[model samples]
Target chain A: MGTINVSREYSVKEKMFLPAIIQGMIITLKRFIQGFIFHKKYTIMYPEERRNYSQRFRGMHFISVDENKVENCTACFLCETVCPAECIHIVAEERDSASNPYGVRKEKKPLSFDIEVLRCCFCGFCEEACPKDAIKLSRNYELSILSRQEGIYDLNHLKREVKGRG
Target chain B: MSSYEISKSENYLNYCSDKIRPLPVTGPDAKPLPKMTLDGQVVEFVPGDTIMQVAERAKVASRIPRYCYHPGLSIAGTCRMCTVEVEKAPKLMTACSTPATDGMVVRTRSEKVLKSRSGVVDCLLASHPLDCPVCDKAGECELQDYDYEYGPSRSSFVDEKRVFPKSSTRKLSDKIVLNMNRCVACERCVRFTDEVTKTNDLVMLNRGWKKELTVGDEDKGLYNDYQGCLSDFCPVGALTWSDFRFQKRVWFLRGNASICDRCAKGCNIEVHSEKEIIYRFVPIYNPKVNAHWICDEGRLSYKMVTNSHRVIAPLLEVAGHGPTATSWETLIPVTASLLKNSSRALLVLGTDSTMEECENLRKFFSKFVQNGEIRYFNGTGITTSSENKALDHLLRQNDKTPNTKGVESLGLKPLDVAGVNGFDTVILFRSGRAGIPSVAAAKNLILWGVWSDEEVRAQKNVRALLPGLATQEKSGTFMNCDGILQSFKKAVEHRGYGLDVTRIIEKF
Candidate 1:
């Protein structure tokens, strides 16, 4: 077969530029109009405004109990042990002997339970490991703190919210 | 001219091109190092080694103090006195726990590090009682030393100091005394007792200001044989030995490294002594052997040597009455005559006897008695059936002797009481009720033990009763259950008829 190499070359004058440039300008002009006039504003002053959360959303943790308002935590230490980051520290003491169902006394109760929010990864492991369904990540997400020490949520803070919810 | 010029030009250009290209250099291995400087001294450390360990290895002139970071224990990283500044890290990091990395700059003496360290020291002091005057661990206490070196002048805490109700000063056992007020909650003693002794007797109780170290339920005292370790492991004056408490300050005693004769575990120990008297025995760190712990049985074994009930002089048998105190010169010949005349003389030895004494007795018996037989007996019974399997598993046999393995290693068989009918004469090496079997069967007995048990002392057939050196009175080796040979030095001289068995056997 006789090879026929098609080679075409033209000076700058052969290329059409006006229509392509016009098409690009039209697209840009349309975006500018949308940005200035048609687009809705998304910005809000964060401190003054708040965001809505779903009913099932997991946020700052809170301990909840049954209808009887009894503390659901047995202080089994399963949640503390399962936490990948050792941010949860639980110091348990024995519950009142008369309150236990087994008639046998225990050696532990949560005397001081603290969760370092700064160190927590919020993976929901604590909630998953709680057999008693005591500790839960609630829908309240306002968890910012000004100081490192303030981020360490103590037992008093946990029990207060837990009592309110219960 | 044109041909020569073209050829030269081509060759020169080729050489120039090759010369300009980067060539790899072959040399000796490059010494890998970090770009950090510590206390103005350039040093190199392997990546991931802590700054404290690196500074220590480099011999840097910096004091990165620590309390919870013992070289022998797992780093608790509680005491933050070793804080040092890193060039890039936001806050100063504790030198004892922080890992060193390549190109990471460290400054231990920088103003920031000093300020942070002083702040930690001040906070630690805020809760501390600062009762160094009467504290037993005052001179040697790590807190006292650090306070003198880097502590702030005073604390600003104006609140009434948190006071824990002093738990009834309880004796955990015969060897240990627990003083709760002096505790700093370092948790070293609890960790040592739990991890090393494997005895879960002591644990941390409560939380925050109410935290204290306590044993199990109120009635169940610390009954473990390793209870004395709490005293040795306590960095503060919290746990003290009943024997050594209030006797003398730790600074007054000079420590000499020695080995324990209690068992075959060959626990290395430090004999703290003053005025030629042993105060206490503390376990020294030996990775292959006992790691910073020893049995309470070993710690209290020093009492036997210092007791007034020891034998001080040699004795010989009188005709009608019991054995009379005689000179060493006369006793040896008299004993030799008795052994030489007897046809079926038997030598009975206590398992507590040292290897040197056993060997010497074996040699002396061979020469002194014409046709005598030698037998071994351990002085204590071994009760092994228990749920505490760790302690039971440590018991080698029913004999609670320290050197039974050593005697067995010497090819001498232990005497079975059931097999022996009777013998003409039997010799006792050490005192214990366990040696009564041989004493009862013998027609005539020669006792050379330190403590006088009623059975052996009252036996009418007993011929000559001589006092011999106890384990603590002599320097000798003992083979423990694990077949590890440990040597103990003479803790003190015998008060009564105590003489080294090696020397006693030499007389015969």
Candidate 2:
């Protein structure tokens, strides 16, 4: 548990440090030649051009909607149960009989569904646990917000039209 | 009051009965109990039990799948989900209907039996709506249980499921909602209404593919008083209790054993609660008390404990502000001064008070109110144990309060016809079971034990209010209408500022 200090004499090559600096300069020159001379671009303009990520990359969350813009989520609570961060909160209520179009299948709907984006670990367990394939993790990773309240997503924000994982 | 006097009594008979099997004793004539082999284990069963019951007695019923078979209901082996292979029988037999014989051998998990169960699930799921996400019984449904155990991962039939449009949104009673498409056609609810309640209010309408459940008389609807029990035994989400329809998912509740204080029957119940909030009360199986069923009144009486209007904080009546919330520090001394200043005080104990509570109140008031007339009031309309009778054939009692007999056993007499007229101060204490009595005579009034804000506002000359725990949140003993003693522990923590009897007494 005690600290030990050992001293050693430096060799001439180690103390001069000229060859070490030259070796580092050669590595940097190789990368500069590949980028400046060969024109192999390593960075892209974020707003104009975007890099493609794998389809399985989990980022923001969205609820899938049907043709009539109705969300497929039945407020099953599978997402809330499987969430490790416990960020998902849902309040379920029975759908109005007069307005329900899908009979008994979608008889219950979420009165309020909220997700604290800041608290979510994005482990993708919610996507795996969902039975109706309603809740999904999309590939849109830009999640920065100006206000603390904007980090919390409501049902209306989640039900926006998401096109092909974007 | 000492801590020993307020110690919560636990009913250890049921809680500690796990993992200990009873020894099979012989009769006086020296005949051993009947034995059967269920899934390689030798089990001793009663004389006239089915093979399914024998498997249940062996604690190996989980290996067998079931839809129509419920232990509380009568046998109707129509589902064929519980089919088992017999050693020497010609064909597979339904375990629910086949009686167990001596040395009978049965295999519940054989390949042939599993294939049969899988086929049964297929047939049952063919017409099922597959709407478990929206169903209230999703987590605890028996049909879903059997389907997961022995069913196909993917179905072959691609045709559309038949839908009963009218019966999909059927209302059997104000307490029950029906959705026929979700039913597995097990006929458990129909038989429950017929055999248990004996009401014959429900019946199956059609045959085979068109089979549907409906009230016997369409015009009359369901007339049974025990309609809540229908939702309990339903294997599917066909019938649901309206009170718990969309309140919470079943998996989120944490259950604790408690007694129903709605009546004197002392029905053992499991309080399903989450975050100190009670979602519903379900009956725990106790053959000595309520057997697998509770009346609608007792099942729904838990709302009184969580009512928003209940006075949860200690209150002191200011000169002009009326009964306003105040801390225990200020209210207790102010209350002690009020009782000390009054020349004569009358203490009224509600019959709803527990045995230990009544004793503590008697000892606490004896020091100050020397000439105080102490009396027990049961405003439930019955005066004595002889007058308390059964209101129905089941658990309902004519005397509404739970512990009239227990209070009377403490040698406390009933309130006089003259009431508390001459006393300068009147102290009334109840645990929410007894009715309010006449407090018009006294100049100074004190209320205790779970009163509502509206109730306090209605009463005049109220000096102080002390909120006390509800029965579910407190431990107490009751002498039921049958003269049987029952004790219960606190099921949930008190969410309000209410204190126990011992804690309240210590403040003084």
Candidate 3:
């Protein structure tokens, strides 16, 4: 069977495309002039410029710490239980009484706290469920990882100092 | 009373309230007991039952809150949590200590009773640290539950809570940690040691506001076999099991009913686990078996399955270097060939094995070995079920194996130590609780069932290893020391490449 070409002929306005090209150029030039001269930029220079997020924005997770720098987490498992994505895994252990001066307040501590950022839905349930106000989400959304293992933030990683919501 | 006598006694009581006591279904010939009006519902009760017991028999005991009214311990009406409004009585009477009379009327949740409970809770909370975030007993603490149900939302007293400075994190013993600030002064632990264990290891020191719990013998320090029971019945986080202290929160644990296989007493237990990892074993109330308490050894027996050294995969002895971890595909054929080629094989089943496993192994080995003899071994010193005896006054048995009586009931003979020499190859099967028999005479040894790395390494003549599931990972029936048949379902999934006995036999 022969191939059928359903081609239609162009009108004068379509055949003469200089006006259309100039119209597109004019819009580009308007944006360029606005960005360069007026400094009204629409896109950010990402590595240097960042978008301002609200205080409640949920991103990477972290464990809160006290003035002594010891984690405030009592390892109550409330966050693990409330996590909708089931990404949080924790192992709790008693703080050595010899080293722990806070007595009953800092008695129990997390032996291992892991959060699979890849699996986490960033729902902020963990932050809400945490009784000790330990687990929290920061506004630092730079979560790109080179490997799968990097996505799993461990106790040491989560214990990293985060100033407020960062 | 000794644990044996406690188990045999018809009037065995539990730490729980009588509300859990199921009333006997009345038959035509059954004697009619006196009736009492409990919460406007007419309920029959035994002649000597207290108001609390009557409520329990009526299955409405939950309506009454309790602090020091454990069925296993003597009544101490100090907390005043179980007070009820009696129709004729001008004052609210304590249900635990007050006996029920014929045609007596009681209101368990009257406004007066609720006000009384709220008062008691308020007093308890006045001294309570309320550090539930770090308390191990947070989810199961009666103080927390009662406070939620009947306590006043706000407190009247604004004074700083009483703190037992030194005793706040005192080590009562290696098994228990005492946080004095969390104690509600229920004195249940004191009563438990005094009445039940009878060791009198713990005592309430001082009077009123300054009251504190201290070990009777400070140097000896809570040296009772049943110390774990103290933590089990403790209504608050005052007494917490150290093994489970910070392991996991109680709310995250999922409990499944299983029997403690550490001893022949076979105390019924609830295996508390999360994600197939056991956290602890708490005794389930079985009046005829273990009544609301298990020994510390049994409670901590879950470590055998969770031990890091436990061999989980098939191991094969290569180049006389010893057993090395290998896959089932390669190990199964080697195990089958070894069994098939052996001239005279001896299958020594550890008495810790369930009756089903013992019988299954016997049948499977008989088919696999042309000239084979199947025998049971209890290497915890006892050779026969008749030789087994109670080690303690409580539930601990001298016979460490859980099913020596069970294996015997299956018509299997005990392993003759001298007879182990005649066999060319010996297959030693156990579930980690049974002691290893002296089978050094056997030239070729095939280790099967839960074996730790150290246990596997000790054997010089071992050929291949077949790792198997522990008691918590499998379902089976065990005939306890008393010849009582108790069956348990798998408490957790086997976190290993180990196959069931039937599955292993099928591969053979």
Worst lDDT window (10 residues) for model 3 chain A?
A157-166
What is the C-alpha lDDT profile of model 3 across B1-508, one tens digit per residue? 1222112121333334444444655788777788989888999887777898787756777788888988777789888899999998989999988988999999988898899889899999998888888888989999999999999989989999898889989998989999888887888899888877888999989988998899999989988888888888889999988898888888878988788899999998889998899989888778677767899888888999999999999999998567888998899899888888889999989999988898789889877789999888888878998988887676888998899988988898888748688898999999998888777788899999999999988888899999899998898888888877887888889999987887888887
Interface RMSD values for all candidates: 16.8, 1.0, 0.9
Q: How well is each residue in B293-337 modelled by candidate 2, as lDDT tens digits?
A: 889999998998999999999999988889999999999999998
In angstroms, the error of model 3 at B431 is: 1.2
lDDT of 2 at B262: 85
- Return the clash pairs for model 2, or none: none
lDDT tens digits by residue: candidate 1, A1-166: 8999898885564476776788889998988888799984567667688676566676787766445554556565666768998898775554554574422112124667889988888888998988666788876777878889999888667653353322
TM-score of chain B of 1: 0.79
Q: Where is the poorest 10-residue window by lDDT in model 3 chain B? A: B1-10
Cα-based lDDT for every prediction: 0.65, 0.85, 0.86
**In model 1 chain A, where is the ten-residue run with the lowest total lDDT?**
A100-109
Task: Please give the C-alpha DockQ score of model 3.
Answer: 0.67
Question: How much is the lDDT of residue B308 in candidate 1?
Answer: 48
- The candidates, ranked best first by TM-score, are 2, 3, 1
Ranking by lDDT: 3, 2, 1
TM-score-superior candidate, 1 or 3: 3
Candidate 3 docking classification? medium
